[model samples]
Target: MASGKYLSILALTGLITTASFAQKSDADYGWVLDSSKRSVKNMPQQNEFLNNQYPYPSKPRSMWELGVSGGGSFIFSDIDPKFGFGGGLSLRKSLGHIFSVRGSYNGSINKGADYRLRNTYDGINGPWNGNYLIYGNKYVANYRTKVHQLSVDFIASLNTPSIYRGNPKTNIYLLAGYSILGADVDVDAVGSNGQPYNYTGINFEGKRSDIKSALKDKWDGEYESNGSIRNESRDAIGRSDKNWLIRHGLDLGAGIAFRVTDRVNIGIEQKFTMPFDDNLDAVKIGSANDFISATQFRLNFNIGNSSKNVLPLWWLNPNNYVYNEVNTPKHMKIPTPVLPDADGDGVTDQFDMEPNTPAGAAVDSHGTSRDTDGDGVPDYKDKEPLTARDCFPVDADGVGKCPEPPCCTELREKMMAKPACAITSLPSVQFKTGSLSLSATAKAVLNSVAQQMNANPECKVKLTGYYKGSDKRSMQLGWDRVNTVIKYLVEQQGIGEGRLIFSLSDGGDPNTVDLMGTTEEGPNSIPAPFPNLQKSK
Candidate 1:
């Protein structure tokens, strides 16, 4: 029993040791793009560099596995009763992905009793003294129970999920292999004489000897033996048989694991195994053949950091708990007309031709819009929006017009046709009824003429003084009047001398006489004065 316990301990230790060394191969990590930044300074631009962007992260650590277990097993198809409790430990390690090695130890107690007849000549019996006491009577015989298999195995673990799982964590699995089973078996039995049938054919009286000799080697100071009983009529003890046992088996199991911390993890698993070869039962009782079966529960403490190795499945991984597909060209979203700021310009780029203009850019009342040309007229309406020269143009009379280079002839014709100065001032200057000073108001008008001539620099006027006359004196007075206007225009008024043109006489059709004094008549007395001095181009 002590030895079996020791074997279990050794198997567990071996499993741990063996599994600790298992590692994932580089191939298992799949392909990961190298992401190191380029160290070279400035280099010539090349098409290759244009296509290259960023690199993928590298695989970080090695992959490893460990496990422990305990359970009961039953041995079958053996002559000796094959029923017992058993338990063991197993460990598996992956060595660089594709290949791995594993080792384990298992122990069991297979107990059963055996019975048979041993005919011995000169076998001791009750003394025949004083009545010829018959010798051998059938005696009951028995053997003490024994156990088997301190076992160990070394095998390769195959079909692992660690590779594809990406996570160094482990999951449910099945393991199968062979084991090297070793054990010591001692069989003990007691023997006794049999009774005779017909008065003297066999000894009827018997002395059964206690068979202590069957006690062979002891484990932890306890006798190790297989018990047996001989023919039903015998009562006696028998010698013990000693031999070696070998175990071969199949292991099947599943387990789950989680990272307790970075490199360490705790795992719990249950396992069942089928032994293919006989254990100590075969050596003790030659005809005994048995198969071992066991169930076990274990806690696996693992030590290994997570691997940075990328797997084919890495594309599906999410860094966070929430997951979804992420697309790039980050800002390309469906556009809305109301929010025309497609480029995210505060000033909707649609209305603002210069979308990216600096803030506080000169604009129309709608603050976001821009004025590309600085002209008072905004670019939107200004024909020659950029030039200050495109202002309103004034005609000769100092009145403004819309079109450029306003038609001076059309404006002059319109004003002249009105008879403002033509009929009124011209006729009035020819005072028919009086002297050069016709009336105080008329004098004032003449004075205004003088002031106008004085103010005008490059202007010229023609003056023809006229009157109603029947004699030369009136005619002469008209001349005197012309002289009076000329004197004011050229000398007193400072009008340029070359500009004044003097004329005399009626200045109108002489045949048309002035119907002077009456309100209804004159030399075509249109309103106040005689008609003359019309402006001509």
Candidate 2:
């Protein structure tokens, strides 16, 4: 019983040792970095290196894990033969993309109470020799009794992809290691005889009582033939002497690991150990004590999913990145041209000004648009390209191309006669300095003018255009200034072109300053002082 208890303690110790090694190995390599070989100095730096040429995360890191399991054992010995059952625990650590190491401890206690023993002695058959003495008696002895044994083991296993527990979903592994074995046994008799005997005694009081009792009970008076002194002396050998022994042995196991999640794995393993020393059984016939072997089936759980990425030893070698069929190194250099059409736009760098146009779109000479005004944008994109006649042909000036003196003079007289008909009173159709866009204040006034135009369809007006310019661009600038106002009246206000008129001049006419001409900013500069349309009139 004492020896069996010690074996259980040793098994528990082995389990702790296994967990210790796993934790140590995990701590040693968990945050390990190989900065000595990683560098940015030799590779393309800053603007010289293209963005895609740089490396990013190759793979996400895997975590570490632990597991445990249990099962039974079959004990064989001459003193007792029985089946005992037990359980154990294990720990494992993953080393990057290649390798992993594991340790585990397991043991069992068998109380082999219902056991049997068989003994058969080959009769010493030979021609009677001078030295050989022949006796005419037959002897047979067997012991049926209770025994206890404990087995403990420590194991280390290697995992591989090509082997077991290597593939992603599930893997298998082979394990081998050493263990300590211990046991305790109580016996009934010694030698090939039915009588109980003891090997030695202290000669103290009450020591020979077991032998005296055995002789009086099961011996049936045959004990006197073997002699009372032999019984008394041999009875000392099997009685009350403490004998506990320990031995180390080899252990082997096989298991399958399955990933339950990204960070955890569950495994089932079966293992057995063969003790090198025979003290494990302690009660065998003759001089040999039979060793012990335990078989256990366990459910193992790994914490960090180490088995998911069991790495190969030579993974860091650049040559390992080779392709077999192509017979070429995957990382070997091959010239790759820098593509010009990065955005996949049809436009090339040289000819296409807007080379990076959207992938599927029509472009102009400058890769912009065919229609600068974009009244309908263009025929390619305009759903209502021909919806409005004003979109097709635009009259630069609101006045008709042919202006007869009688008709023009008549219209001008009527415009000046109205009290609210002055150019300023038509709401401020202001223009930007050196631009045709109307300002916020100008837009407000223009909106009012549009409202008035919508109310009075019969009203007619002439927009006399002028520019504060003293250069070759004076006429062009003045024309654009007048054109802007005319477009607003006709296009925006829905005023008929025939109802509006425009006065175009190369520059502000000095002699006709008292006429209906208006002053504005210079073509290439800002206006000095605002021109008063009243004074000009």
Q: Against the hidden reference, what TM-scores do the models get?
A: 0.33, 0.33
Each candidate's clash count: 49, 22
Window of ten residues with lowest summed lDDT in model 2: 223-232
Q: For residues 1-537, what per-residue lDDT tens digits would candidate 1 score against the true structure?
A: 323653674476457545633633222212222222221231222223333432223232333445555555444433334245655555555443333445766666654432222332133221111112233432222222233333233223233333233333333233445555554443322212221211222222332121211211111222222322222132222223443333455555544443444434554443444554333332223444454445445555443432432221211121211111122222223356464644332334455455553432333212232323334443233343223233344333323343443658776555435222211122134343543444433443444444333333334455655545555554555556665555654555466546565555565532211111111211210121322432111
What tens digits encode model 2's per-residue C-alpha lDDT throughout 1-537? 335743774575456435533321111121112222223442333212224354221232334355556555555444344446666666655443444555655556542321221222223221111112222222222222222333333333333222211134444455666666443333333333633332233232343444334432442322111100111223111113443334466667655554444444555555556654332332234655444444444454434334333232211221122222135423334588553544333333554455555543444323432332345453235433222343354333221223336758876555435333222233235454556565544543444445444434444555655655654344455555566666665677676666555665545541221112122312322242233321210
Whole-model lDDT values for every prediction:
0.37, 0.39
Error of 1 at 352 (Å): 11
Model 1 TM-score on a 0 to 1 scale: 0.33
